[model samples]
Target: MDEEQLKIMRHSCAHILAAAVTELYPGVKLGVGPVVDQGFYYDVLTPTPVTEEDLVKIEEKMHEIIAKATTFDREEIGLDQAIDFFRERHQDFKVELLKDLKEKGTTKISVEELADVGDRPDTASLYRTGEFVDLCRGPHVQHAGQIGVFKLTKLAGAYWRGRDGNPQMQRIYGVAFETEQQLEEYLVMLEEAKRRDHRKLGKEMGLYTFSELVGAGLPLWTPKGTLLRNILDDFVWQMRREYGYQKVTIPHITKKDLYETSGHWEKFKDDLFRITTREGHEFVMKPMNCPHHTQIFDCEKRSYRDLPQRYAETTMVYRDEQTGELSGLTRVRSITQDDAHVFCRETQVKEEAYKIWDIIERFYAAFGFELEVRLSTHDPANMKPYLGTVEQWDGYVAELKSWLEEKGLPYRMGLGEAAFYGPKLDFMAHDSLGREWQVATIQVDRNMPERFGLHCVNEHSEDERIVMIHAAIMGSIERFLAVLIEHTAGAFPAWLAPVQVRIATVSQDFVPFAEQLGTELVAAGLRAELDDSDEKVGKKIRAAAMAKVPWTIVIGSKEAEGGDFKINVFGQDEDLVVARDQLIATLLEATQRPS
Candidate 1:
């Protein structure tokens, strides 16, 4: 089934679960039941807290309710009547919702009731299954039995309506599927995901960390993680330099007027982190780098010769993300974008886009990802809902579509997925577990130039509009790190690994030799670590492997005496022994960026 239909089915199962919950605990108060990822959950308040062990009993009761083929009765009742009904059942969460509605001018009066007085308000919508009734606006299944296969997954605590100031409620999570086979497959994938969970693996691998005192969503990169990020950033910088991107820098915070001029303040003011100076000047931490790049372009007068002035920066941009939205590196308050903007004449838009597309292909392919293109365009039928006029949007979309087709690249067109300012080509790369991630993006914009009055002198010495192309092969370094960890399962390739080679000695007797060899590797521009711990040889080797180091060099008496290089490569069965010079050459070859 489609996602929406599956949501409906899962939502219906939530009702059965609620019904079974109330059946077992007569006085349990319902908070809210909403459909979640792959399943549904009901926030409930109970005198006795629910634990994981209770899930089986709850599942059994849900099966009983499903067996009865319980029908759901949906009704639109007067606001007062609905409030009174839920009040009698001691559903305080429903009362809070009703009060919120009341404050928003909702009333028990309907159009028919207010025909004479000309005063009407929306009535409350609710659903009933057996003796269990809850407040909801539902598209639930007709009968409880229609929910095919389901499993209660886990339980966690949640606020009444996600407000910290509100009462705590127990959130029960579950998954629903159209078929038992699908359910089984999903469960297996879920287990695999747990094993590949970036948050879990990140900590175990010592890549990054988060501190509550430092606040949520702001990651403190450890030394190892910083190396990995710098490596990725440096590589991208070198790659873009070949594409004529000039490295640039801008301030982290800007006066409110800058964003106001760029239209970001109006659109994302609430999402931005705002600050006020001692002089009462309003400012905001930048949520994106494009607006600042526009200023750089406008700093000097340009001609057709400088039509395509590309600027790139790898810097942190801040956002005030909600606490609930914060995850590992995937979602964070501080985002580092390999952001670049290319200012070109209208005719060069196609060429610039092609260059970026080529970059994306080479970049992701080097990392073992075959990307698919998605052309996100504005909805044709609706012009009022979009950022730009129909003609401008259509041209922007058509250029990307034609460019991809001309290159013989397959792509999918996604309507109503375009950004507010322009249409874009998004590159999606799937991980090893078949989960798709949008890592790279390309956008063609005409609005930003207009907003900033950006123009270049044409052949006739007349001011002409410049098309801005925003391209980033690695959208966000933090997010890419999360994806990379899961994709390679922390065993990064030799070139990208934070610790390229870990030198483990057979004992302290060889510590001097191990350190000397590590120094040589470092001098040759390779990252290597020497382990002089008193641990056994086997333990040291295992330690190096567990850290996912690309190479483990074990130095024993024989190797130390003979000076023969023996290396254990991750994910390889055969041991590698080579001449000292040959090994250094191999290291240099493997660590160099792909051509």
Candidate 2:
């Protein structure tokens, strides 16, 4: 089925799930059920705790409900009547939601799932599927039979309305598709994704670790993980250097006035880690680098000859992310951004943006990632959430579109997805698994320059306003690594692998030779490790494989006595035999970073 149909079906399936749950355990107060990326999840406060084993029974009940072919009937009820109706049923969550809608429209409701409720001041919408009724503004499937195929996947605990100190609700997750084949294919991909989960592989490969003392969402990178991050960051820097980008540094904490001037204070103040000085001065940990970079550009007077002052920095920014929102690398409290900004005149915006595009193309190309561009523009309907005038926004957006057109790059329009200050070209990369990730971005900002009064003396001797172009090749190093680890399934390419080559001896007698070979490989610019312990050769090989090293060389008596060495390549069935010099040459060539 088409995407819209699939969404409607999945949403209906969520209602079906709620119906089954209510029947199985009566007196369950429903929160909300929303359609997510792969499927749907419903949050409800159940009278009795629900276990994973109960999912099977819930699925059976859902199937029975679907077999009945119940129609989804939507009704509009008066606000007071809906509140009383839910209150009578002891669905305190629904009553609270209805009351909030009655008093404050939708502004007071923080639950994202209920934002779509097109409720009038006097009335609210409700959907009825069999005996289960839910407060929803939905265009659901006509009947439960249209749900096609569905499976209850898992369950978790969630705070009511996603707020702390609130009653916790049971969140039941499920996936639905149009056909059995599609469902089976998705299930297989999910299994493979689980196998390649970065959190599991990272621990197994000793890439990074998380400790309770370090707190949630704060990951501590191991030595190898730190090396991997440096490699990626250096590669990005190399590309930026070719475009005349200069490195810059900024303090991690700044006076609150800095962000206030840049407009981030108003929009992202809640996410900032605030600090108080001894004298009671307010400061905030930087959550973004663009604002600080602006100050660097403004530090000196400039002429039009000095236009496009490119400043690049790889630094960690702090954000007070909720613990529940934290995941492996992807979502973290501390984010490492390979951020750069270019201060240029209006005439030079395209040229500077093109330079960034080149860097981005070359960077993702090294990983064999196919990119799809997205033109994220501001929502014309909502002018309050953005900065700059309509004329400014329109001109900047048109300029970005023209760049994409000139490059002949096909892109999708993401309405209402632009940054608060400007429109951006978001690069979405398709990995080996066919999963898409938003990897890089280039934004044209006329707002920040205007806010900071950044300008340069023009040829006409006029103080001409400059434009700021925000560019990030890796966006966030942690998130990019998460994607990279999963995309390669921990078997990174030779140049990118943390441990490129592992040298193991057949016995302790050849330990010196293995150590010597390790030094040679390292001298040849390969990340090599020696397994000189008294473990058996087979065990050492297994250990190397577990570490996902690209190359593992075994040293035996023959190899130790001036003979060609056999190299075992990861993911290959055959072993390559080459002279010592030839092996070093091959590895040096393979491990060379992309230019």
Candidate 3:
């Protein structure tokens, strides 16, 4: 179906949902009901809390409304009349909205804003379904019957009009499909997603934790979580060495003046956490690693050949992301991004971007992540907020888009989504449960160079500003680890597994043998552990399985006598019995990156 038709159907579903809620709870006040990406939601403040069991009654009511097949009649009424209608029904939220609408007259903005800005304070559009009516600018389905296959998926508490301090409303979320089979398929996917939820699995595997006292949005990494992070650090460092990226480190906080000069304070001050030290120096936790890297580039004079300087850092940064928005590890206040900046001459910008994209593709391939690339450009109408000159913005955006097109790369355009200082290419990936994430990004920045006075002499020995390309192969290591956990369902690949091999002793008699085998594996540079805690063999195996150890070696009388081990590969189809030397060689070969 077309976008308009799909929206009409989804909006119709929302109306049915609202009708159901009103019938079940007579005095509920309605908030905004809108169609989102996959479904629709209607916010309501009911007398009693809506639970999962309550949803069954709501669904039944919805089905009955749909069966009645009421035509969605549209009516145009005066602002006062609309307010009176909803006020008589005790929907204070609607009355308040109507009063605001009448008070704040329309302003001329754009075609998109026209609906929101009604020229006539005399009249507003109202959509009526059976006995229920809502103030809406809608083009809904012809009849309620068209909402054929839909399911009320979930519910959550949301603030009215997205204001946290406002009254909280219960939001009922539902998804619609054209056919019953499609609904069934979506339900199955949701079930599978629940099975692989990172928060649930992360806790089960002892990966990470959060404490209410320590505060929200700040995740405390457990010991096993740290091991997972170290594995990623090792892997990325190896890749950086191969790709010729110079490693660097910077402090987590810098003077407020640095952000002021960089213009980040003016543009993104709210997202940054300000810190004051004992010396009375006002500082802010770095929201990004770019400005610090710029300082590194400006530390000394540069030659033309020194252009295209690549500096990489696994840096920790802080953001004041709202507590409500934070999730397991996907969203957090503190993040460690595998960040790098390429300071290159204007002519080398495109090539440098292409090189960064290549590196990202390779890195994602190692972890089995496919990408969707988006070219984010500035909107001319919104140019006042962007830092660089119009000509520079035009040239950089055109060059990046042209290069992507020339290479036959598919990309969607995201208007007005650029960083405050630059245009960027956002690389997104879908986790195993089909939830999309912004994983990596490559940005072309023209403003930062001038801000920091970064310069290199050209062929004629005249100084020129260097263009900076900010790229992160894996955007944030912590967030990426969360995705990785869900993607693999905690079964990490052999190379990344925290404890790659677990040596299980059949009895106390074989405890020494298990320890010796673990020693040998550790010496071979593998993460190996010996299980000799007086637990039964079956119990030890189960515990190792829970840890998601990639391989397990059973050390019994037969294997010890032969100087070999019986190995079982977790999450794999087969087993192999190999001598110590042969096993190490095979593992090393398998773990090495493909050329």
Candidate 4:
């Protein structure tokens, strides 16, 4: 179906849902019911709260209405008549909606006007199904019977029209499909998503927590989460070592002039956290790592051979995010980005861009993620203010396009989405729930190099300006870890698991052996925890499972006497009775990423 037809179908479905609710429960006042991406939802003000059980009954009512195969009829009515009709039915929300639409300069119709009654206010369409009618402009199926399969999925408290000041309305979310099989598949995906929810897994594994007193959108990483972050930092630094990246550190905030020269002061000033010093110099928290890396470039002089200078740093930045947009770990106030910049000759721009892409792909694939690539270009209408000279922009844009084409990489082009300084290739990864996120990005910037007056002495002894490539493989370490938590369902790969092994003893008799084993594991560069609490074996195992340690090595009288450990791997049924040296070697192999 076309987009318009799909929208109408969804809108009609919303009416059906509202009708079902009204039938199942009397005296229900309805708010607006709108069609979303996959299905439709209706907000209702019921005297009694609608529970999960009510949703089931309402869904059954919907199926009964669909079985009736009612035709959808669209009727036009004047604004005054429309208001009066809903006013008589006590649907004050609809009347208010009409008034708000009028305030927004929207035009509609009146039924009285059709009969030539004194200048009818305006006309609007109402879709009718069975005995149910809703204010809507509909393009529905021929009959309600054509709605093959649908399911009520979730319920939440939402404000009327998503405005905070409006009265709170209870929202019921539903999903429909062209086939019953499709609906079942979607339901299965929803279950998987719940299982992989990062908030749920993070809490269960003691990885992170949030507090109302600490404010929303700020996540406090627990000890395990902090350990994971540190390990991730070591991995990235190791990867950078082979790429000719020099590590550098910079403060979290800089004077406003730094951002002004970088143009972030003009473009992203609103999102920045601005502060004033005692001298009244306005400073802003750094949102991007590129400007500081540029300053480091300007600190020295170099020849043409010194071109393509790469600077990599793990930096934390802050942003002011919309309150409603806050999510568990996906959206946050602070981010530690795995950021880098490469200043290279113009001829090497494509090579550097591709190199970054390679690194991003490698890292994501190592964790079993399929990469989706997109090229975000300048949208002339909305992006005219951000970019530089037309010819200069064209040169960089053409080069990026040519590189992608030569590399034979499939990518979608997004218009008007380029960064202020240049065009970028954004790499996206879909989670277990099929939600896509931009996890890595590579951009070619000619403007910054020129702005900084950065040049290298060429073969002809002339100073030639350099081009810069800004790229990040993980985007942000903290966010990536959060994603990883959900992606792995908190059972991280043995290599990256914060506590790789937990040694437990069945009794105090084996406590000494457990401690000794843990120390050995620690010496082998593994994070090992010894559980000698006065808990039963079953309780200790449960605790280790809750912690999401990769392995649980049990040391009982038998194992201690035999001078060996009994290992049980998470998510694997295989158990091994192995020597200490062999166990450490195995772990080392697993932790060593393939080159």
Candidate 5:
């Protein structure tokens, strides 16, 4: 089925889930049920706590409800009547939502589906499925039978309206598809995803670690993990260097005034890590690098010839992310952004953007990622959320759109997805598992320059307001590593692998030769290690395989004397036999980074 139809089916399944839950446990107050990326979830305050083991029972009840083929009847009632209906039923959450809708006209509601009721502020829409009624603005399927195949995935605790101080609710998540086969396929993919989970592989490979004493969401990179991160960052820097980008540095903390002047203090103040000195001066750990980059640009007076000054820095920015929202490397409190900003004339916007685009394409291409482009533009209907005037926004968006067209590249428009500063080209990369991730972005920003009063002298000696292009090849080193680890299942390419070659000896006699060969490999600029521990060759080979090293060389008596080396490549069925010189040459070739 189409995407819209799938969303409808999933949303219908969510209502069915809510209906089943309320029937099984009466007096449960309902919260919003919204359709997410792959499924739907409903937040409800239940009388009894739910656990993973209870999912089977919930799924059975949902199945029973779906079997009845109950029609989903949508009704519009007066706002006061709707509030009274939910209030009588003791669904305080629903009543609260209805009251907010009545008082604020849906402006306060963050739920996209419920936001549709704004057109008729005096009335609210409700959907009835069997004996259960929910406050929703929905275009549901005709009946429960049309919900297709569904399975309740899991349950978790969530705060009401996502605010920490509010009463917590139980969130039930489920997935729905048009057919059983699709559901089965999705389940299989989910299983594979778990197996390829970056956290699991990272621990197994000894890449990184976390400690409670060090705090949550903060990762301590092992030597190998640090190497991996450096390799990735250096790769991006090499590409950026070729494009006339110069490295720049900035302090991690700045006075609150820097952000206030950049408009970030107003928009993202809560996310910033704030600090107060003994002198009672307010400071903030930078949450972003662009604002700092602007200061660097403004430090020097510039002529038109000095336009397009590109400054690149890979630095960590701190954010006070919610504890619950923190995940492994993907959602960490400390983020390392390979950020760059170009201060250029308005006419140079397209050229600078194209340069960054090329860098992004080349960078992701090295890892075999299939990329899709998205043009994220501001919502014209809502001007309050953005910084620029309507004409400026239109011009900036048109420049990016025109660039894409001129390059003959296809992209999808993401309305209302633009950053508050300007429009951006978001590059979504498809990993080996067919999952899409937004990896790189190139934004054409006129707002930040205007806010900072950044300008350059034109040929006519008149001050010309300049534009800034924000480019990040790898949006975050930590998140990109997470994706990369999962993409390769920790078996990175030879050049990118932390330990490219692992040398293990069959006997203690071969240890000397193995060490010599390891030294040779290291001298050849290959990341090599000698497994000289008193372990059996079989066990050593297994350990190397577990570590996902690209190549493992076994040193036996014959190999110690002068026999051809037997190299066991990861994920391969057979060993490669080659002379020592040939093997070294082959490895050197394999370990060469992409040019």
Candidate 6:
């Protein structure tokens, strides 16, 4: 189903859930029922804490309500009647919401913003099923019975209206699908996702850790995690190097004047970490590297021949993210970006972008990700928020669109999604579980160059304005690794695995041979780990396998005497016995970059 249709179904399902909850607990006050990605959740104030076991009874009640095949009748009432209606039902949460809407003089709501309440005063639409009523602007199913196949997944505590120190409410989450088969497929995927969840696997595999003492949203990489990150960094550097990108470095913090010149101080000052020196100079942790890269470009003179000076860096940027918004590597305060910027003549914009597209394709293809393209353009209704003039915006947007068309790339146009400075081409990738993520991005910026007054000598030996290209293949290294870990289930490919090969001898007699083999592999540019633990060889092999090593080498007496080693490849049955010379050659070739 399309997103809109799916959202309608999920929202209908949420109403049924709320109705069931209200019936089960007479005094429950309804907060809100919103349809989120993958599911829907309803927040309600209950008399007591709702545990996981309560979900069964609630779900059973929901099924009963659905079986009744009751109609969902929508009605429009006066602001005061709506308040009185919810007040008499003991749904103070709903009554409070209506009061806010009434005070804001809300008279109409857009169909697109059906679930977005409180943010703006809009029309108040109410829906009723049987005797249960809710204040919502909904396009629900024709009847309660048409909610499709759904399952209550979990429960959590949420504050009323999402404010801290507010009354806590029980939020029940569930998944809904159009058919039973689709629901089953989604459930199966959920099971696999749980098994592959980075938060869980990272701990079990010793990949990374978090401590309250150090802080939240800052991950401490273990030896294994650091190895994986380093390998990824090397690969990205090599790829960018081939694309004519030169490495550069910048300080983590800069004087406030730097951002003020770049417009970030006015736009994102609140989202930055500000510091004050004893001398009273204000500094802020750099939230992005594009501004810093531009200073480097301006530090030197350039001509048309020097156009497309691509500078690349893998550096960490800090943002003042709310603590509650923090998750594992996916959402963090400190983000490491594989960031690069290109300063080019206006005539070179398309070529520079083409090069960036190639880099992005090669990087994601290396990991087997499928991509979708989007051309994010300016919103004409609100030009005041953007930095450049309408002519510059329209001209660059037309050029980008023409370039995309000339290349015959299928892309979706996103209105009002452009950065405040310029348009961008965003690439969304599909992971192993069929979930899509916004990955690489290439943004065309004329504003920053103008702000910095960047220029290059044209063919006529006259100063001309230049354009900037902001490219990030791996948007955030931490977020990328989190997705990668979950996508691969921590079983990284042979070339990327932290421990490429694990060697364990059958007994003390073969220990020396195993150590020699480990040394050989290491010398051949492989990450080899020798199992020197006191565990038996079988147990050691199992441990290595659990660690997700790409291969495990067993050194037995036969191998020591016969000069043949057995290699057990991960995710494969049966072992292959080959001469040590042949194995070393195979590993060396396997680890090298594909030509």
Error of 3 at 569 (Å): 1.4
- lDDT per residue for candidate 1 within 35-58, as digits (tens), equals 887889988887788889999999
The C-alpha stretches of model 2 lying farther than 4 A from their native spots are 107-120
lDDT of 6 by residue, 1-595 (tens): 7889899999999999999998998788888899988789999888876789999999999999999998999998887888888888888888777886776544223222333344654446789899888898888988987788999998887777655567878889999998999999999999999899999988888988998898988898999998888888888888788878899999999998889899988777767999999999899999999888998998988988988899999999999775645778999988999999999987888888998898888888888888988899988876766897777788878988997899898999989888889999999888999988888899999899989999998899999999999999889999998888888898888888888889887778778888887888898789998887678988987888889988888888788786777888888898877786699888777776542
Candidate 6 clashing pairs?
108-122, 108-123, 109-123
lDDT of 1 at 388: 79
Q: What is candidate 2's lDDT per residue for 225-287, written digit by digit as tens?
A: 999999999999988888899999999999999998999987887789999999999999999
Instruction: Output the number of the TM-score-best candidate.
Output: 2
> Cα miss at 562, model 4 (Å)?
3.7
Error of 4 at 412 (Å): 3.1
Candidate 3 residues 1-595, lDDT tens each? 6667877798889988998999999889998888986689999999988998898899999999999999899999988998899899999988877776786643221223343443557667899998989888788887998776989999998877655578998999999888889789889988887787889988988878899998877888898788888778767777767767899899999998998989988777878899889998899999999999999998988888887788999878999876556777888999988899989998888888888888788878887777888989888876766897778788878988898889898899999888879888999887666777788899988888889889998889899888898998788987888888888888888777777888888899988877877787789888788888888887887888888887888888988787766787787666777886688887666555443
Query: Each candidate's root-mean-square deviation in Å?
Result: 4.2, 2.1, 3.6, 6.1, 2.8, 3.5
Which segments of model 4 are wrong by more than 4 Å? Answer: 1-8, 18-37, 40-48, 64-146, 159-167, 255-261, 265-269, 276-281, 300-303, 380-397, 431-435, 447-465
Error of 4 at 123 (Å): 9.7
Ranking by TM-score: 2, 5, 1, 6, 3, 4
Looking at model 4, residue 487 earns an lDDT score of: 80
Which ranges in model 6 have alpha carbons more than 4 Å from their true place?
Answer: 77-123, 157-168, 389-391
Candidate 5's C-alpha runs over 4 A off are 27-29, 44-48, 76-92, 95-123, 163-169
Clash pairs, candidate 1, are none
Q: Write the per-residue lDDT of candidate 4 for residues 1-595, one digit (tens) a residue.
A: 5566666666677788999988876777888887886788899988788998788898899989999999888888876777788788778777786664444434222222223233433676777888877776566777898775788988988766555567777899898777778788878988987888887888888878889998777788888888888777777767777777888899999998988888877777767888999998888888888988998888988788887899999878888765545678888888788899999988877777777777787778778888887888876655454558666667767877887788888888877678988988888898766767788899888888877788888989999999889888888776787778778788788888888889888999988878887888899898888989999988888788777887898888778776656787777677877775588888777667544
- Every candidate's lDDT: 0.85, 0.89, 0.83, 0.79, 0.89, 0.86
Models 1 onward score TM values of 0.93, 0.96, 0.90, 0.83, 0.93, 0.92
RMSD of model 6 against the true structure: 3.5
Better of 4 and 5 by TM-score: 5
TM-score of 2: 0.96
lDDT of 5 by residue, 1-595 (tens): 8999999989998999899889888888888899987899999888888788988998999989889999999999999999899999999988888888777676253443343453547988899998999988898999998888888887888888776678989999998988889889999988898999999999999999999999978899999999999999999999999999999999999999998899998787778888899999999999999999998899989999998899999999998877757788999998999999999997887788888988998899999999999999999988766897889899888888888899899899999899989998999999998999999999888888988999999999999999898999999999999999989888898889999999998889888888888888898888999998899999999999999999999999989889899999899989988897698899988888877
